[model samples]
Structure formats: structure tokens, C-alpha cells
Target: MSGVVLNDVIKKYGETQVIHGIDLQIENGEFCVFVGPSGCGKSTLLRMVAGLEETTDGAIRIGQRDVTRMDPAERGVAMVFQTYALYPHMTVEENMGFGLKMNGHAKREIQTKVAEASRILQLDDYLKRKPAALSGGQRQRVSIGRAIVRGPEVFLFDEPLSNLDAELRVEMRVEIARLHKDIGATMIYVTHDQVEAMTLADKIVVLRAGRIEQVGAPMDLYRDPDNQFVAGFIGSPSMNFVRGTVTDGGQVDVPGIGTVPAAGLDAGREVVVGMRPEHITIDPAGDTHRVDLSESLGGVSYVHLLGGNDKIVVEERGDYRSKEGDTVAIRPDPAYLYFFDAASGQRLR
Candidate 1:
């Protein structure tokens, strides 16, 4: 296994700069995922590390070697792209062994590597088939197997599962996770899917507009986000942000929900209160609002309430009897509530 280090990396296209100075250290055998929206430089960063794109400044080190200016083949890294870049004419076995063949490895060694990779990826049964004969997931596995046969010190994936169907994506995700465990190689993956980043990564680097927003374990970012952006981006259904002004008695007065005690906040300061949908519950005896909609999802139901002028979603356990236009009292758990500075969007204690 090999660790990758990027020191103050920068990329520029003539006068237009895309990637700001980025410094990141990916540890050996760790699964680090880069997640962000489209045109956020996630793919550009991955390509830079793979030697496909040149870095305008700074250095890139894979293991102990400085490979900033090295050719793609010279670097001990294998990349799996979004499109299954398999040769249509070649059989699965041939495609998997092609890298080793080009590098002039012994025929027996190439065969052994291909067989091992195929077994690991569960592609053993389709070795003689061409790319067209394989399913989308199977073909993606072949693409991964091709990388594995090269015995790269590090593996880089650029949205390798985006082409597959939803079910196939899940299946491939499990396969990729298992493959990481079995191979024990350092892998860096780039994707826009939060679920993928949360499930597959040992560490996640969240980026925004050419700069990193936050980097930490999935739960760390989810539970204690540094700012509103990280808080809103990391959670499913997203965290709800209610705009309110801090009151004189150390409380935030929502337009219709009345004053919520702001224990640690200074009085008379404007702030945005954030709470996850799942953290809010329906309280029958408390202040109530008319429910606009209720979506039942087996184990839990989400109740959307019209809180005066604001809309609040409450997650209730089991079946909820609330219906449209029915008033239901709802309250947010204090412990899960977060505060952010209204102007800067930074988290406040």
C-alpha cells in the first residue's frame, strides 16, 4: 500500500485558475473520497493525481516518490474511469491482462494476475466473453480488474459506478468495498453522491468551488459540521434552516414558532437555527401546526407542517395518523439543534 500527498497543489488554464492551493494527505490503505457538485474541481483534482492533468504549481508525492511531472504510466497508480474503457474486440481475460502484456511481463504471471483479479471481482464465470456480452456492472468489474492486474500501489476511481442502474450501483458499491478489504491498497475515489461517500470512505473531503469545505470521517462531518454549508450538504433530506433574529433574553424568535432558548448564544444577535429532519418530533400536547403532507416510509414517517410562514418537516417513528390540514404539535430536540451566524454562515457555540 502507498500513501499520496499533495502539497499546495494548484491548477490554472492560462489566466483562468480552477483549483486553488490544495494540500491533502491520503494515508496508506485508506479509502479517501472526494465529494462535491459538478464543476467543483473534484474530477480535475483526481486527474491531476493520476498524471492525466498537469499541475501548474506545487508537488505530488505517491508513496516516497515525487511524481508531479511523471507520465501516467510511470506512476504506480491505476485509474478506473466513469465510462467502462474496455476494448470491444478483446475478451475479458485479454482486457484484464493487457496492461501486464504491454509491460512485457511473463505470460504465466499475466494469467495468474488476471485469474486472481477475476476471482476477487466475481468475474471468473465471464472470462471468455467480450465487453458487449457483459452486463453494466460486470463490465465495470472488468474495468476494475484491468487495474488490479497491473498491481498498482494506489487505485484512483472517477465515478466508476455512475453508468450503472440504481440496483447495480448498490451491488457494485458492495463489491468495491469488499475489494478494498481484500486488496488492502490505498484508493482515492471521486463522486458527487453523498451516500456513496458516506458508505465507502474512510475519510471524506468535501469541496466547493475549487476549495475544500471540510475533511473528516463521515459521521464527524454529519454530527458536528463546522459551518452551515457542511451541515446542509452532508445529511439526507438536508438539515432545515430557519431564519430568525436573536432576542434580548438569549433566545431566537422564529416568525411563528415563538422564542426558542439559545443557551450558548449571545443576546440580540442574528442567527440561523439548523436542525435535522429526523431530530424533530411531533408533540401532541405542545404548540401545534396544520400538517401539509405526511410521507410514510415503513419504519418512519415524515410529517411536513406549515409552521405559520415556514415549513418544518418532522420525522415520526412508526405510522403517524396526521393528515393534510390536521394540526399536530411538533418540537425540535434541543440537543440536536445547531446555530450559525446569519451573515458569515459560520457555526456559533
Candidate 2:
């Protein structure tokens, strides 16, 4: 297993800079995920570490070796792409062993490696089957098995599960997590899916438009996001941002909702109060509003309340009978309120 270190790494396409200077240290055997929206430079940064793209400046070190200028083949890293990239005509065994064969490994060694990888991936039964003969999930496993056979120090994945169905993606995600635990190799995965990042990563690096937004454990980023963007991006339903101005007495006045005490915050500043839907409850003795929509999602129901121009989504336990135009009183949990600077979107005390 090997750790990856990036020191002031930057990537440029001629004159346009895509990846701003980024410094990150991924621990040995750590499953680090890079996640963000499209055009966020997550994939660009991963390719740079894989040596598939040249870094315009700074250094990349895998283990003790500086591989910034090294060829992709020379870097002790294996990359699994989103498209599965398997050879159409080659059998599973041949495809898995192709890299070792091209590198002039002994025939016996290639066979042994292929057999071991197939067993690990549970692809032994399909060893002689071609890509066309396998299902999407099976083909994906072959792609991963090919990487495993290489015995790479670091594995790079660029949205490898994006092509799979929703159900298959979940299954493969569990398999990948188990594979990482069994192999204990440092893995860097790039994906736009927040669920994948939250579920699979030991550490998540959140990026935004070529810059690092935040890097932390999944819950850390979710509970204490540095800004509105990170908070909104990390959560499922996204945190609700209610515009309010801080009064002289540490009270914030929302447009529709009446003034509420700004706990742990100074007064006389414009702020945005953030409340998660799960943190808000339908209070029996609270301010009343008309429910615009209620979505029952098994264990919990998301109740969308309409308060004049302002809207609040409250997540309630069990089956909620509240429907459109029904009156309900929704109150946010005080302890869960997040305050952000209205102007800069920075968190406020």
C-alpha cells in the first residue's frame, strides 16, 4: 500500500487553468473520493495523479517516488474508467492478463495472476467469456479484476459505476468497499455522486470550479460545512437557506417567519439561517402554515410547507397524512440551525 501526496498541484490547458493549486495528502490504503458537480476538476485532478495528464506545476508523489513526469505505464497505479474499456473479443482471462502479457511476464506468471484475480472477483466461471457475453456488472468486475491483477500501489477510479444501473451500482459499491478492505491498497475515486462519496470514502475531497471547497469525513462535511455550497452539495435534500437579517439583540428575522433568537451568534449582521429538512419537525404548538406537498418516503415523510413567499420542508417520522393545502405548524430544531453570512456565504458563530 502507498500514500499519495500532492503539493501545490496545478493543471492548465494552454492559457486556461482548470485545476488551481491543490495540496492534499491521502494516507496509505485510504479510500479517498473526489466529488463535485460537472466541470469541477475532480476527474482532471485524478488523471493528473494517474499520470494520464501532465501537471502544469508542482509535484505528485506516490509512496516515495515523484511520478509527476513519469509515463502512465511507469506509475505504479491502475486506473478503471467509467466506460468499462474491456476488449470486445478477448476473454475475461485474457483481458485481465493482457497488461502483464504486454510487459513480457512469463506465461505461467500471467496465468497464475489471472486465476487469482478471477477467484478474488468471483469471475472464475466466466474466465473464457468475452465482454459481449457478460452483463454490465460482470463486465465491470472484469475491468476491476484487470486492475487487481496489476498489483498496483494505488488504484484510480473515474466514475467507474456511472454506467451501471441504480441497483447494480449499489451492489458494485459494496463489492468495491469489500475489495478495498481485502486488498488494502490506496484508492482514489472521482465521482459526482454524493451518495458514492459518503458511502465509500474514508475521506472526501469536495471541489468547486477548479478549487478545493472542503475535505473531511462524510459526516464532518455534512454537519459542519464551511459554506452554503458545501452544505447544500453534501446533503440529499439539501439544507434550506432562509434569508434573515440579524437584529441588534442577536435575533434574526426571516421574511415570512417571525424573529428568532440567533444562538451563539453576534447581532447586527445579515445572515442566512440554514435548516435541514430532517432537523425540522411538524410542531403541534407552533406557527401554522399550509402544506403544499408531502412526499412519503417509507420511514420518513418530507412535508413541504408554504408560508406566503417562503417555503419550508419538514421531515417527519412515520406516515404523514398532511397533503396539499393542509394546515401544519413546522418548527426547526434550535440545536440544528446553521448560520451563514448572507453576503459571503461563510459560516458564522
Using all chains and alpha carbons, the TM-scores for the candidates as numbered come to 0.95, 0.95
- Whole-model lDDT for model 1 versus the true structure? 0.90
Per-residue lDDT tens digits for candidate 2, residues 100-215, read: 99999999999998898888788999999999999999999999999998999999999999999999999999989989988899999999999999999999999999999999
What TM-score would you give candidate 1 relative to the actual structure? 0.95
What's the distance in Å from true for residue 264, model 2? 4.7
> What would the per-residue lDDT of candidate 1 be over residues 9-121, giving only the tens digit for each residue?
99999999899999999999999999989999999999999999999999999999999999999999999999998999999999999888998999999999999999999
Q: Which residue runs does candidate 1 get wrong by more than 4 Å?
A: 284-288
Per-candidate RMSD, Å: 1.6, 1.6
What lDDT does each candidate get?
0.90, 0.90
Off by over 4 Å in 2: 284-288, 308-310
